[model samples]
Structure formats: C-alpha cells, structure tokens
Target: LVVFLFKQALTWIFGLLVVEKNLISYPYRLFFKKANKANFSFEYFIYPGLCALFSLYYPKNKSNLLKTLHFFISTSVIVIFEIIAVKYTKLIKYKKWTWYWSFITIWITDYVTHAFHKWFFKTKFHE
Candidate 1:
C-alpha cells in the first residue's frame, strides 16, 4: 500500500505536468474530465496497482544484474502495451511524448518506489 500510494502521488504530479505540457492526452477518461487533464484511472489506479505488484514481487536478495533485468522487463512490458495503445486506441495519445519518455519515467518511478519500500520495511518497531 505504501508503494502504491507513493506511485500514485508521483503519477498525479508528473502525469498532470505531462498533460498540461501537451506532451500526452487522454481522450477517454472515466473520471476527472474537467478538474484535470491527466488520465485519472491510469494515473490513480492502474499504474499504482502495477507498482504495488512490482514492489511486492521485487527480488531483494537477487544479484545486481538480475535486479536490473527485472526492472528492464517490467518497464518494457508497459512501454510495449502503451505503444500498441497509441497506435490503435484513443485511450492515450502522444502529442510531444514518445515511448522512451514512458519507459524512462516508469523505470525511475519504480526504482524510487523500490528504494522507498526497502527503507520503509528495513526495520521493525513495537509500540
């Protein structure tokens, strides 16, 4: 839940900036059509849920190479699907954005959230 919320907060800020900058758009949002330009569903729910999964399943004891591979594969899957959505769907549109932006942002956010998760659960306390 911590990871999910962290991702959600990051997305809310960055996603709004991307939309406000005309870098990307969502033509078919389920909510927040007037209050914001970003895709609420994706930024608020979908991406955060995915981040939770990423943090939960992350291999903490793995080698550096394996950890890097995990990040690469997870980020690549989202970028590949996003490319397809851009090509065939009206869910997301790229104005000044590209697949690399999504890839980089996702990778960075996931890395940050993973680091947060580690620091968060690193020690136990009782009151």
Candidate 2:
C-alpha cells in the first residue's frame, strides 16, 4: 500500500515535469509532424508515468535471477504495449517510427525509477 502511493506520487511528479518542460511535444514534432493530422494529449504522458511507477513496485520476493528476469519481462511488456498503442491505434500516432527515441526515454525512465525505488525501499527477496 505504501509502495503504491509512493509510485503514484512519483508518476505525478514526473508527469508534471514533462508537461512543464514541453517535452511532451517531442513525439508529435519529431515523428508525427508529417502525419495527416496530430493527436497529442496528456494521456500519452500519464500512461508512461504510471508504468514507471508500477515498474518500481514490481515484486521482489524471488531469487536474484528470477527477479532480474521478471524486471526484463515486465519492462518489455510495457514497451510492447506502448509501441502498439502509438502505432496501430488512434490513441497516438506518429508520422514515422523514428519516434522510438521517445519510447526509449520512457523505458529508461521506468527502469531507473524501478531500480531507485527498490534501492530506497531496500527490497527483499525470500525463498
């Protein structure tokens, strides 16, 4: 419960920072610029923010190898979803897939946040 709240807080903070910095426009500017039209919104930013927070709270009760595997699996799943959401659906669109850099930024942020949270909380594993 406490961890969940912490994750939410972190997500909100990052979301706000992205909005303030106008970094959210990077996707549309870099990739979706030549598209028939652009549909940029805060939703795109919020989802990744939440994903980062959730990744940070991933379970840590398995062996080290298992835990690492779980992290990779979890992160990959989120990245895949993001790709699909932005590419196939009207949820978000890009003129070109070169927008991969934006997704990479989100991925790295998620991994870093998860790692930072695990360290700050002293995540423990058990048999």
Candidate 3:
C-alpha cells in the first residue's frame, strides 16, 4: 500500500509536468478533464499498481544478471503498451515524447521506487 501510494504520487507529479510541457497529451480523461492534461487513470492508478507489483515481485535474492533482466522486461512491457496507445488510441499522444523516453524514465523511476520500498521495510526485505 505504501509503495503503491508512493509511486502514484511520483508518477502523478511527473505526468502533470510532462503534459504541461507539451511532451504528452491525453485527448480523453476520466478525471480532472477541464483542468489537467494528464491521464489520471494511468498516472494515478495503473502505473502505481504496476510499480507495486514490480517492487513486490522483484528478485531481491537473485544474481545481478537476473535483476537487470527483471528491469528490462518490466520496462519493455510498459513501453510496448505506450507505443500501442500512441499508435491506436486517443488516450495518449506523444508530442515531444518518444517510446525510448518512456522506457528510460520508467526504468529510472521504478528503480528509485523499489529502492525506497526496500529501505522502508529494511528488515522485512532481504537479499
């Protein structure tokens, strides 16, 4: 729950920033339609849910190679969806943003969130 909320907050802020900068846009929004350009569902809900799942299932005791693989796979999956959304849907449209940018940011933020999660429950999480 903590990790979910934390990721939600982080993504929410960044999402708004990206939209404000015209790097991304959402033609259809489920919330805050008249006041915000960001997609509330994806930023505040889907992404946080994904981050929570990623952090919870991270292979903490695994080898470095496996850990890297985990990050690659998770980020790739997300990028794939974003690419699809960009190509086929009005839900998200990239202005100055690219798929690689999504990949890089997701990778970095997920790493940070995972680190925070581990630190917040240090004794409970073991490598």
TM-scores, all models, native as reference: 0.94, 0.49, 0.94
**The 10-residue segment with the lowest total lDDT in model 1:** 118-127
Clashes of 1: 0
User: Which residue window of length 10 is worst by lDDT in model 2?
Assistant: 35-44
Q: Write the per-residue lDDT of candidate 1 for residues 1-127, one digit (tens) a residue.
A: 9999989999999998999999998998889789999999888998999889988888879999989998999999889999999999999999999999899999999999898888898887667
Ranking by lDDT: 1, 3, 2
RMSD of each: 2.7, 7.8, 2.4
The collision pairs in model 2 are 31-95, 32-95, 56-114
Which segments of candidate 3 are over 4 A away from where they belong? 124-127
Error of 2 at 45 (Å): 13
Question: Per-residue lDDT for 7-108 in model 3, tens only?
Answer: 988997888899999999898887989877888888888999999999888999999999999999999999999999989988888889999999999999
The TM-score, computed over Cα atoms with residue i paired to residue i, of candidate 2 is: 0.49
Stretches of candidate 1 off by over 4 Å are: 124-127
Which has the better lDDT: candidate 1, or candidate 2? 1
